[model samples]
Target: MTVEFAGEYFPIQPGGRFVVGREGDLSIDDNLFLHRHFLEIAESGGLWWLANIGARLQATVTDATGGVQAWLAPGARLPLVFATTSVVFSAGPTTYEFTIHSSEPTFRETRREREVEGDSTIGEVPLTLSQKQLLLALAEPLLRRDGTGMSAIPSSADAAARLGWTVTRFNRKLDNVCDKFDRIGVPGMRGGAGGSATNRRARLVEHVIASRLVAKADLTLLDVGETDPADAE
Candidate 1:
């Protein structure tokens, strides 16, 4: 098996364990928000396992097709069953991602029916074109990134400017989008108790990308504004 980040690859020997974080075998970065040893990958029981060892941070695991996804919370472990497993997470203001390729994967991608309805959605809650534009603005950096690696999440103001919108307009849209997701049982979208708006944006980006709700194809929405209206209501 091999792990990839920024085009560099690290091969994991059979039965060997590898650690990843701010200070681990992968040493994701020197960011203080990242744990010293966040994720551990090991060959156990004739299978590869991905475990979350960090107390504060969580990782998003998905298959190569992004059709299957799981949240790896602290102490959680998942089998590396897919031919390629992509891991994504956020630490502080930056988001990092990497891919794990297994030479002997147990599971393979096949046609699967859509579990949720709508062209873009969460639990049947469809995303408006305007909301999609907001997401594209926020996710532009990550979409433009070269490979599996770290990218800086744009601030609300920066994202707003990218959409050719005023801060007030941008903030209002952001509030609406967050509120929509929050109502649909999505966590970390609310402020005050959950986290600050800054943290919320990072979580939003992490979830959307991990779930394949937004892709590079959606980035073009920025060029042509959403016709849905200022107030989607």
Candidate 2:
């Protein structure tokens, strides 16, 4: 299906489908493109789910378990806010209900399904596959720059600019990266600023040292535990 949202065309499914834009038309793989788009939305802001096309038309997600997820898909021309769940959507017969689940979205397949006895529900909807992809893509560069000599955090805006993104988009990518890092227990993401920077630097040094030792492990002349004066010189 060819879906048009906010005057832009995006491929809805697999085929020789493309989304024509000012820069150029992009061929989209529905399974993969949504994930990438979600990241793009996140990079522009900490959250991308709010910007979904289904957020508008006063869409409400009600699962059989009575879980209510409400959001507004406001057009992209408006300013950002938390008041409404905004989505830029195509003019289609919007389906307020879906069989989608968060577990079926991305790499979160391990999510355990819960059954409410009477009605134990939360007001959260199933996140799109696009959103998941966005998160994964955001984690890559940030993770690369997190360990060893790359421990220093870079300006997300600068990185976004290099990728032809606006400043807003860059910040969103940084937020997604941080969230992923926290989930994976990479450390340093949630520490005090001054201490965190110092700790990361120290870890980087240790990592480099360990790597060097491993590289020269075959050379008996260079011992990892030795502190010989002759070897130092």
Candidate 3:
């Protein structure tokens, strides 16, 4: 198996293991928010498994196309089943990503894109144009990034400013979007009535990318800026 990050690749022998974190076989950034040894990649039972060794952080695992996803929380592990598996996680205000390449993959993508029926339903999650714009603002940096480099998820205020709106307006729109996602049972989206604000932005972005809820094509919304929901129709 091989790991790709920032245009660099590292091959992992079946007998050996690779560690990813602030300091490990693959040393990441110097951010104090990250664990010294966070994620562990090892071969078990003839399959490569990616495990989250950290107690706080969780990883978003998906196929290269982002059609399938799995959350790898602490103490949980997932097998690298795709030919190219991508893992995304958030540490502090920054989001990090990496890709695992297996010479022999157990699954391959065979599904193709179908026509859209009505509102913007990204993976069956209906989104309004305004909500889509909100997501584009939150996901702009991540969308612009290439390879496996770390990207900072903008703060709500920053994202609001990016969209030329007041913080209150941004938060309102955020609540609406989160509510829609919760209705469809998207995990970690945010529970109604009592939901903490911490990590909500990061988790949203992580899930959006890993679940293929948003893609680069949506980044054009950032340039279009804020718009009326009716105008997009």
The predictions' CA RMSDs to the true structure, in order, are 3.7, 21.9, 4.0
Clashes of each: 0, 18, 0
Candidate 1 root-mean-square deviation in Å: 3.7
Deviation (Å) of 57 in candidate 2: 55
Better of 1 and 3 by lDDT: 1
- Model 1 misplacement above 4 A: 113-122, 146-152, 193-195, 227-233
Q: Residue 179 deviation, candidate 3, in Å?
A: 1.0
Give the per-residue lDDT of model 3 (tens digit) for 1-233.
Answer: 99999889999987789999999999978889899999999989978899999989888899987778888999999988899998888777677888899999987677677877877654366677778888878877888875322346677899989878889988988988887777767776774454346457666776787787788888877667435655232
**Pairs clashing within candidate 3:** none
lDDT of 1 by residue, 24-84 (tens): 8899789899999999999888889999999999889998777788999999999999989
Consecutive 10-residue window with the lowest summed lDDT within model 1: 145-154
TM-score of 3: 0.79
Clash pairs, model 1 backbone:
none
TM-score of each: 0.81, 0.22, 0.79
In angstroms, give how far residue 209 of model 2 lies from its true place. Answer: 16
- Model 3 alpha-carbon drift over 4 Å, by segment: 110-123, 146-161, 164-169, 191-195, 225-233
